[model samples]
Target chain A: MLEVKDLRAGFEGSEIIKGISLSIKAGEVHAIMGPNGSGKSTLAKVLAGHPSYEVTGGEVIYNGENLLEIEPEQRALKGIFMGFQYPVEIPGVNNAEFLRMAYNARQINEGKEELDPLDFDDILTEKMKMLSMEKKYRERNLNDGFSGGEKKKNEILQMAILQPKLAVLDETDSGLDIDALRVVSDGVNKIKSADNALILITHYQRLLEYIQPDYVHVLSQGIIVKSGEKDLALELEAQGYDWLTPTN
Target chain B: MTTTLVDASDQAESALLNLHKKFMSGNRPPEALVPLNEAAIQRFELLKFPHRKHEMYTFVNTKELVSTVFNLPGETVVSKDFIKSHVYPECESSYLVVVDGILNEDLSDNSAIQSSINLVPLKDAVDQPEIKEYLADTIEKENDVFSAINTAFISQGTLIDVAAKKQVEAPLQILHVSTGSASGNVTSHPRILVRLGELAEFKMIVKYVGVQGNYFVNSVMDILVGEQAGVTFSQVQEDATDAWHYSKTRVQQGRNSRVKAVNAFFGNKITRHHFEAHLKDVGAELLLNSVSILNDAEQVHHFVRIHHEAPHTNSTQNFKNIVNDKSRSSVDGTVIVNQGAQQIFSDQLINNLMLSDNAHADNKPNLMIFADDVKCTHGATVGQLDENQLFYLKTRGLSEKVAKELLTKSFAESIVQTIDFPGVVDYLENTLLKKLEA
Candidate 1:
């Protein structure tokens, strides 16, 4: 389970997400929808312990641990994953190698046995098959020269391999096509179990039709103003954020 | 073996005294010491040992290195098993051993050498009339001090010749090993001369390794490519860190010829390398690449010059350095194009990844041109790892140290990935991993 107590985070000196709070129980998917500059991505980044975004206030408690106090890598070892809106292009670094390292990082952190090269290949191949990723992606540099859809699917593939306790998807559906979206969504659904929680951050409600969130929350001006069941996502999709603003 | 810093007063001064006297009092220098033995010595007399004030020698001062002496080297013998264990582990290779700056004839391969290929040591190459003529005629006599010193006090080296249109199936491994003691501060000159005939293709791997001792090595190499010849050379410097090494490599490419070079520098207290490539004919192509990792108080400087003389030529040069501790590095590269060299496409980029705050890297990419119809660009960047990439990697479950190492390795992979040999590529990767972990 994950509980955020009045989280306030932002860049340099100014606060972007001010006094925001939320809670998500295990085995459930939570959707956070907001307009542009509403600080949805900021919240996800803060939870992932990005150094650029300073957490001036608030506490992020995840599975009984203060996530904010640890470094980004430590947070990652504790089962926190972020699927970026735009994946980085690390040329000359093989995708297979990076994925293996990521998997081993968590294994080592949990005091579990790590996988060797042969076993790593076997498991990674199975995971890649499920994601429908081309075998060539294994040898190519991470996200280097990759298309929008490939980058998105690769992100999903990483999430599948890490099998983290909590995953924060940050606009993962932005540049993906319908085929890529369906594949990524299916991969995410396959990994959802009783031991982990999913935080879906998106502006459009299209991805919700596949993952099916347990609760829908509307964020604006760095604050959560509304929360309800799945029906709220549909309502917001139909009416937009116009009605939420105060009138004269 | 560790090289302790002796005070400038007693032991250190005596070491310097012994090295200098032994150098000047030695018997008449060998004939192979220079392209023009007497003429080159005069040039050496005019130039002085390098000082820190020299822009190219800023990080590594040759004066401090040459002031000490080394034991004269003896016995140019290397066991076959040692070569197998150290240089080529994956496959069988034809080897050339140059011990103490002199060619070890018994250890070298002659029967396996191709019919079109002529392999001779400097002891014999100097006797050939044509060799003497071209050795000094192709390039200018040394204006720099260290080069003149190498010319004036040199002993021997290696000469490789590949006939026109001949291609060697196996890679050539050139091993320059240092052994023996000549007494107070020792010095030796090693030279490599390679000539590729028209339409020939070959790859050479040169290793400059030390036998155990605090020695100083000074070497110069001359390489020439004939019309349409293609060559790729890789230099791996894992010499003794306690020694001072100063080296130079000069190359010239003929019509339609192509050359690709890469240097892997991983050693020494003070090491300096200079590379110059002249594209003197039409349609010539050259690619220069290098990667160096320096730690402790070590300093490494690499200077390169690429001159384009004809139209329709292509040239690209890139050098990367990873410095830690208080080590320092510098890269100066120049790409010149003449007026007649229209349609020349050239690009030079020098990038450095500094691992510590005190470590420093100075990179300068210079360009001078007399032609307007050419594509030329040069840039340099020095900084730490990318923060975004670091964060993204760490968020994937890697520890901060692991993530940083991966990124740094990736930065170097840009150049190493271009190596055509898969085994060599993997070997370099593992070596870099160890360095990063350290």
Candidate 2:
């Protein structure tokens, strides 16, 4: 479902994702893990069309469309979702109102009828229950004063609503407690299907325990140095990245 | 001494001269208002008209606006349909319609209002000494050109007096409509005086609307909140594109009195508003909130001053402006804490959002503290919408326009949400949404 070829990206003339390539099929979950400053988060942002990063070389293809050529909003409309490491705080925009707009935008893109606030409330209630979010979360400002766990759960709730073809989870488990991590991973695990793919980017193998991945790739210095099965994560967790460093 | 009227616009000179000549010719001058008119005209002749060089009129040019020769407005011929269509539909309240500067009793309905609240035309109550006192007391006669002009020509107005310890259930709606004269440009001077007795609670809405034409409107409002009284006053200005308007609201609060004021300016060619509040005794509170949404080449200016005379007083001022096209808006606010006014808390915040390169906003906040123990802070911000917030909305599949519209709506929503009237809130929300979409 996703193909990346020699993707080279960076910010302001400094190369971050230096010459990397990866391909993943449908129904597959890929976990990209590495130590700090290893370009793990940069790769996720590059694929999600973050305007800050200038793709100096290579391309990304998704569902036969050149995803790199599209805008971030177009990428989203075409079933691509990015769960940020730090969700922004929009003080005045209501969370439910924002979710409805996103849902309706996608509906319009797919040539389907839009749902009004009353109609969308039921769907939102079911999703909130799945993530154990309180009703107050919907009425509050979008991530304005939400706790660390609430923000992460809200992101996953959006993922469930968008039902994107490819989901990029960037440090989704960084600030979450044990129970929140399980809830988030459980939400992601339930959404996984035969036609969708997810890329889990994390520094610890803690999240892998809840939502196991089919492939684990060790990334260092902007390049995927090794690719292996789930056992590779256990190995990296036991021994730090010093043993896996490529040493140029 | 022959007043020189130095550095004045030709139009302002002409307008003042015409009005003076008419007044001197004994054109139905009331016996009680002759001295007041004479004094105001003398002050007008002395001060002339304020220009850009004047400190208070720095960013606005009053020369061109005062130069236009507006026909002296008289009784207007308005249809019932016009009056009905223009009334605010959101809230069902008693309406007092002032047409072309005259209080139209036939058009005003006060049957629904509580009996404890008194609504009467100033002209009818001019015989009472208290009516004369309010008219002469609230506004400053010296150094204020517009208020003097309004006083010099005050013919019709409304006087609302609330009974002591009485709470009015429904809001009082004062609708001021200016319909251009048959011949040419017309000007209207409307006045309002609201007095709430001790422990009285009331809410009032003042709406200024005009038809499309060359018209000038000068309005003055005097509000007095008694001891332990609470009043919420909301004003909306939606004038014609060619209309020029100047309004001043002066408030005096007694011990422990509270006042909440909100003003929204959405239309006008040239609009200027002045708000002054004096906290006379301890524990008085004031909240002054305003929003200006300007587009095209329109201009709006707001000048506010709050005086804390007694200790333990609190005041808050929040103002926002959204400018598009080549429009310009400015706000100048000053909070003064007297020497004995210790333990006072004051905060002022001004935020401006510029949608285009040509749009401009000038914000000035001043704090004068004579007491060392007072807590006062003021800050102003000017910029476009947050790029990250916009991008986040876009990533949620919203178009750029929708994203910006939502963000702009959010900025204004912070103030509009404080309005408890649902109909007024909905109307303001839709109005702001339309402006954002445009």
Candidate 3:
């Protein structure tokens, strides 16, 4: 469903994701783990069509289309979703209303009837119930004053509502407590389907224990150095990325 | 060439003075307001029209307003349908309609709230003691030429008085509509005085609307809150595109009294609003919020001053401006804590969102604290929408235009949500959305 060929992207004049290539098929889950400043988030942002990053050299094809040519909003409408590591806090936009807008946008894109507030409320309520999110999240401003764990849960809630085909979860497990982590993982697992794919970007293997990935790729210095099964995560957890570092 | 310009400016200045003289010549004020009118005219003469060199009018350019020749407004008869369409649905039977600065008793119906509150035209209430004591007394007339001019022609206005220990559930609506004369441009001076007794609670929504043609509406409103009284005042200024609006609102709070004033400006070619809230007694609280959405060549200026005169007083001022195209908006807000007013808390914030490169916003949030152990903070921000915020909304599948409009509406919602009245919020939201779309 997704293919990245020699993705070379960065901000300004500095290169971050240099000469990285990866591919994922339908229903496949991939884990991209790297050390700090290893361009893990940069790759996610590049795929999400972030405006700040310049793709100097790369080709990303999603669903037989050049995904890089699509606008950020068009990407989302075309079933591309990026779970931001730090979701922006919009102080006055109600969370429920924002979710409804996103849902309706996707509905319109797919030639479906738009849902009004009352109709959308039922869908939103069911999604929140499935995720075990508090009702207060519906009325509060979008991510304003939300705790770190709550923000991550909200992201997962968005993923559940939109039901995106390709979701890049960037640092989704970084700020969650044990209970919240379990709840978020359960939400992702419930939303997972045979036709959808997930890319979990993380620095630790704790989240892997809940939703195991089909493939694990180790990224260092803007390049993937190793690719293996789920056990590679355990080996990396035990020995750390130091052993993977090349001695020029 | 310079002499010709000076002559034109002098002719414009004298036009207003001549209009005042002609108005007083035909209609003599009541005996109780004779000296007040005389003193106001004298003050107007001494102060004259504001120039660019004036400190208070530095950011506000009055060249166009002062150069225009304006005649005293003639009688204006508006249809009942127009009044009904302009007023909020909740205030159907509890409204006062003022046309061309004169209260239209035939069109106004306060029967729903007349039992709980006293609603009288200023012309008929001049003999009352409260009217004599508080009328035109709250505003500072030393430097405000508009206030002085409004006082000079304050015979026709509205006076509202709430008794002690009364909780008026119905919101009082004052609709000021300006209809220029058929002959030429006209000017109207509308005045309002509201007094709440001890422990009284009241809510008011003042709305301004105008018909086509160029006209000026100079309005003055004074509100006095008694001990433990609470008041919520919402002012919506939606004048015509060619109209000029100038208003001065002064509020005085008694011991333990609370007042919340929300001002929303959406129309008018040029608007100047002067607001002052005095915490005269201890424990008095004041909340002042203003939102101005302007586009094209529209200009709006706000001068706000909050005085913490007594100990333990608190106040918050939030002013937001959404300027688009070539429009310009300025806010000069100052909070002063007296020397002995300790334990006072105050904060002033000014947020301006410039939607276009040609748009401009000038904000000055000032703090003058003389008392120790007081908490006061003031900050101003002038910028376009946050790029990160915009990108976030766009990534949610919202189109770029929809995303920008939503973000703009959210910026003003922070202030709009603070308004507690029903129907007013919906009206403001619709107006804001229309402006954003435009």
Candidate 4:
């Protein structure tokens, strides 16, 4: 579903992701674990086509097409979804209206029928029940006064509504409590399908316990140093990331 | 540096002299308003047009009125087609049409609301006792030059009197349409007087519509809310591109009365609005909410003041301004708590969104708390749209233009949603969207 070849990117002139290559097939879940500032989140943002990150030297192929030239909105239309570490607070836009518009955008891209307000309400209410979100959240502004847990749940709610092909979760468990973390992980586990892929980027190995990953890659200073199975996560959790860091 | 108001331009001085001559020669109604008109003329003579050097007129170019030749109120040739096209199509209301400062009997639709209350032309209400008492009670004609001008040269207006305990469901629509003069620029002064008795309820919608010409529409409204009464007044100003508009609304609330005033300004070359609310008795309440959108070289100004004269009174002022291009807008809000008006709660907020680098927004939020127990808060914020918000919306598959329109519409939605009338909210939303894109 996704392929990256020597993906080197950065913010101004300094490179963050230095010559990292990774590829994943459909129905597979990949976990990229790294320390702070190890380019885990930068890879997610670059793949999502953030304007501030310049692609120094790299190529990204998604769904058998070159993805570097696509705009952020077009990338979204092509089923590229990024769950931001901190969702932007839009104070005046209604959450329900925003979700409906996003859902309709994808349906329109694929030439599917768009749902009206009444029909969308039924679908949205069903999804809210799945995520255990209160109906009142639909009436409030999108992430305006929501707590940390509510923001993460809102992102998951959008992910469930959009049903994108490749979903990248960047630090979705950082600010959540134990209950919220379980609920979020449960939501992602429920939405997984054989035709879609998931990329879990995190600083800790705890989230891997909720949703098993097919492959676990340890990222250090922008490059993947070790590739192993779920047991590698336990190995790293027992010993710190220092034992695995490669010497120059 | 020192400044003097006596050194104003000679052209404006001559303009004032010509208006005085027209006022003297105009026919009188032989009513109690004659002396009030004379007193207003005397006051206008004492304080000519406000100059740019004045503290209140510093940000505004007061000379815009003096540079052009504006004719006095004359014949109105407004047709039925113009009136039908100008009013809101979907909103249902009882209409009162004032064309070129003259009340048109044939164009108004008072029959729809005939059973609610008393609505009559001001000139015909000379014999009514309530109209005589509330006509010039709340407005300050002696200090405000425009108010003085409106009083002296008032051509035609309305008088709305609600009987005790009467509640009117239909909103009274006052449409001030300026069909520019055929000879030269025209100036029309349309006045309004509203009086609600004890426990009475009323709703009014004032709309200003004009043709494309060099014209000036100076409007004034006086409202008196009796004890336990509730009133809501909404004014929507969408004048012509070449028009200069000035409006002043003064309100007074008795004990336990409530008043809510909403204003939206969209189109004008230069527009200035003054709003004042006086809590005359204990437990009086006031809410002043305004929204303005200006682009290009258009200019809009708002001067708002709320006075807590009695104990246990509450007042709130919220204004949102959206400016783009090279346009400029200013808002000055002041909340005054009297010496004995303890337990008073007043707040003022001004939010400005500047879309372009050259657009200017001058905001001043002031509070005068004489009583130590009063609680008053005021703040003003000016900023561009959030880039992170834009990016978030774009990632949801919305194009840049649609994202911006959504955000801008959301900025004005909080106020627009408060309006419960059908189609009014949609009309305002569409109009604001068009203005933002323009």
Best by TM-score: 3
Q: How would you encode candidate 1's per-residue C-alpha lDDT over B288-386 as one tens digit per residue?
A: 888888788777888777889899999988888888888888887878898788999999988899999999898878899999999999999999999
Model 2 residue pairs with clashes: B11-B67
| Model 2 lDDT per residue over A136-233, tens place | 99999899899988999999999999999899999999899999998899899989999999999999999999989999999998888899999999
Off by over 4 Å in 2: A32-40, A91-94, A139-141, A144-149, A174-182, A203-209, A215-246, B1-14, B17-35, B42-46, B120-142, B281-283, B310-312, B340-344, B373-377
In terms of lDDT, the best-performing candidate is 3
B59-101 per-residue lDDT for model 2 (tens digits): 7778677767776765567777777765666435487888867
Please rank every candidate by TM-score, starting with the best: 3, 2, 1, 4
TM-score of chain B of each: 0.88, 0.93, 0.95, 0.92
Tell me the docking grade of candidate 2: medium
Ranked by lDDT, top first: 3, 2, 4, 1
Candidates sorted by DockQ, best first: 3, 1, 2, 4
Q: Write the per-residue lDDT of candidate 3 for residues B1-438, one digit (tens) a residue.
A: 778867876787688778777877776666666667778888888887776678778679888888888887766678898899888977888999888888888989888898999877676776787666565453233468888888887666767889999999989899999987556688888888898999999999999998665898999888989999999989999898888999988888999999998889985688999998889999999999999999899889998888899999999888999999999999988899999999999999999999899998998788898999999988999998898999988888999999988899999887888888868999988875478876
Global lDDT of each candidate: 0.79, 0.84, 0.88, 0.83
lDDT of 1 by residue, A46-128 (tens): 98888899998889888888888888888878888899988999976899989998898888878999898789999899999
Cα lDDT tens digits, model 3, A155-175, are: 999999999999999999999
- Interface DockQ of each model: 0.62, 0.55, 0.73, 0.53
* CAPRI rating of model 4: medium
TM-score: model 3 vs. ground truth = 0.93
- List the lowest-lDDT window of 10 residues for candidate 1 chain B: B1-10
Per-residue C-alpha lDDT of model 4 across residues B20-64, encoded as one tens digit per residue: 666656645336557556666667777777766766666678876
